[model samples]
Target: MNKSILRVAPMVLSTALCTTAFAYTVQGTVTSKADGKAIADASVSLLQKGKSAKTDQDGKFTIHEDEQDTTSTGIHNQQAVGFVNLSQGVLHYSQSSGPVQVKVFDLMGNLVSSKTLYGTGSVDLRQGINAKGTYFAKVHVGSATQNIKFTTDGNASAYSTSKTKSALLKAGDTDKLQVIADGYDTLNVTLNNLDTTLALSLEKSIPPEPTYKFGYALKNTPTPSKGCGTNTTLKTDKKVENGEHHVVNVNGTNREYFITLPTNYDNTKQYKLLIALHCYGSSAEDFVHHTPDYDHPTPYYGQQVLDKNGDYIFASLQAVGGLWNKGQEDHDFFGKALTTIEDNYCIDTSRVFITGFSYGAMFSYSLAQDYQDRVRAAATYAVADYNIWLPQEKGMDKNLPIAWMNVHGVNDDRCTFDKAKNSALPRMLKKNGKASDGDSQFTDASSEILQENQGSTGHLCYDFKNVDERFPIKFCTWPGGHQWTAHDTGNMSVGWNWESTWVPEEVHKFFEQF
Candidate 1:
């Protein structure tokens, strides 16, 4: 979370000089208006004395002799420089002597907030750093020569081992804080209640950045809406049920699916098509309720609620084989299911999307690759990026340029977050692009980070833009189990946490881009 500090206290100036025919110099002391404390070594110049005097440790100084009626002097102090631990939300930029500008951007490329400081002081960031992801702040003075970046993230709840949020802290409670500086490795600090005077040595960069590799090759930027298939091409029965099952026969095998129209379906408008695939051991009916959140239904279902202005038609389809990514029958499921929706609904040929969990999630990746022309984008949860099990026959489509998003939990033994982030995405990202790629360049992947943790759940979000032009793939994680993490709204942060399991809502929001 980003915070603003608002406070301004003027500096006190006073001078005393002997006034006599032979008197020439003056003396003065400079004090800070903020704490009424004397500021040592402040520069003071007396015009009458035609000389300058520096304030001593006691904020006292004497000037040389010059003919004058009174000692008249002007004082100037050096710009204050220091770091403020933002966890407390008290801001120092507001109290800066020179002009300053602050801007914050979230990992997903969303600009959280920006402020320009002339002389205001301090801001409260109680909601800013509370389990949010790594935020990048650009702090600059009137000149661009000394601009700097601040990386801030932490879970206040984690400050205390106690599970109870209230037990985390209270006014007057004292605790030792540990910080690592540039040259020095570590330092232990003790702070009091509202201890605003704390300062520490800073490095060229407070948060060191990760090194990035460049070079990429992408086919073209894929739009969210308008893929390969259209209503005019997939000729099938137009009439369909909103909830009950609908079957389409392929080679004598009856394929079953459930179609749910948007809440306000209009023939004149084409809606985005969503193919919801169930995880292992789950059926089409089960999938209708599995998406967004496993415990409750989402706006994806017209019978449930209307989301995004009722602009999407959902087709919940079942895998022909017991397992997806198994064979040809299982392999061709998306093409058939998507074509069925194209035949029946007024859908934008380009905005066709797929989302699934577990094995279904893996299948969504395969589907996007095999049918790149039809499926523009996809989102999968409880699955890792490089965890593909494509049969030998379907492996040839390995290098497809597609826009994708994934959500997995670190606690998921089945699909580990570390392996996916550290192994899968990196490898797949390189494979998905050639060394010479888009205008964004391979080295400049977005790499936005949003880190949040509530209790035992740690939510992390990362984005890699221009994996292919306009085809930014984003990855998000939370401290969760193998199954869907239950909605932990009470513990989540309003700054960026999800209402019903952050993954589900974010997935829906991701597809909305198309």
Candidate 2:
């Protein structure tokens, strides 16, 4: 994954300079401000002169600068230049001042190869070298010379002089300096004179915050009332019972739902609430009890894990017409159901979660966006941004970040993985503060990789870097087709077996994080 670097704007600081032309040395120690610890291996660069140095074990680095006359020397004018392509083992040179003598030397100071190229050409450095290691190329043009260090591993170190640690700058010249390191913000400084020892402290970078709550109130702003706490009445059309269907009237339309309370339930104890949405043509009862295969019992998508933990309240909601049309009516029904549950149960307002599969996953994505402040996180499988209608135009804040985890089959046909990869995942990643150009392990071009991992055995999951820490976004891909718990039997067809299902366990682990 590609990491994002925060670059600070250059700020010039004035310093006293001597009138006489003399070389000056700038030395500095880089340290972390968070714990007052030395930061070793940090890169300090003179951007204008293309000179840089790495801090030693003690976090100390010295850059020696010599004042030079640019007009008298061809080196400063760059009349002759060499480009080293380490991967191809070639050194390309361009010289305007006659023939150039190029010599390659190994790290042990043994001469490897020598060649003479005129005007512009390339020399094959691999001709006389067989071992893979660091080598240096010395190019002499007229009275100027250049040394380039390269490795067989496709890395070319910067151009250097005979001293290797020294760089050139005109007297009283202004130059931009930069310092970069991991887990810290990039620092930029401009200086006019050098001959001094300095101590530089790097500030630790702050982790990203959830975008979904950018302009919203605190997550725990909702409080229990009505049937909660001292109030004993469970607000509903019927008494709350495990595996029993209940009704809630939304906009004069009755919607069906079922609740599964922990065996050791307490009216006063606050518990995490998880709402499970059923896929198209699947009812709430079928989702909870219908077994995928005859060999084992129903998994109920994390219900087993929840029952083992015994601190969670699980509820499954049914869609009218056996389909989520992605309309306003379903959105309103969800809102009413959530309000009714929170009003009646002693619920932890900050730990509410939602999950589903297929069309159900589509609605879960919609609800995650519409109820960003109310819902803590969402985990789904075989989800797509298209095909099913989403409440994008419901006037909800789209900038808010929600901790999201999605599992999709690269070979899914009903709700294709292309829609999720191209639209859904990118939107969530962007809202969570990830860079658009950053590298990702999950890509539309990874069909071969996805195919290799296809089966009931294993899958690939990528946790995006540089995203909001509080609301992380994870994308996982499996090898089977559009099924709740995908099972591949080596024919690229969906197979069913309760023991082979991994979705429920993965979802349980994700929700347990909060």
> Against the true structure, whose TM-score is highest?
2
Every model's TM-score: 0.47, 0.51
The candidate scoring highest on lDDT is 2
lDDT tens digits, residues 230-262, model 1?
Answer: 333433344443454677776567777787766
Task: Supply the TM-score for candidate 2.
Answer: 0.51
| Residue 399, model 2, lDDT | 61
Write down the worst ten-residue block by lDDT for model 2: 4-13
What lDDT tens digits, residue by residue, belong to model 2 across residues 214-311? 32223434334344465535444554324556788888998988877778677777778888888876767765566555212363574545457676
lDDT of 1: 0.51
lDDT of each: 0.51, 0.64
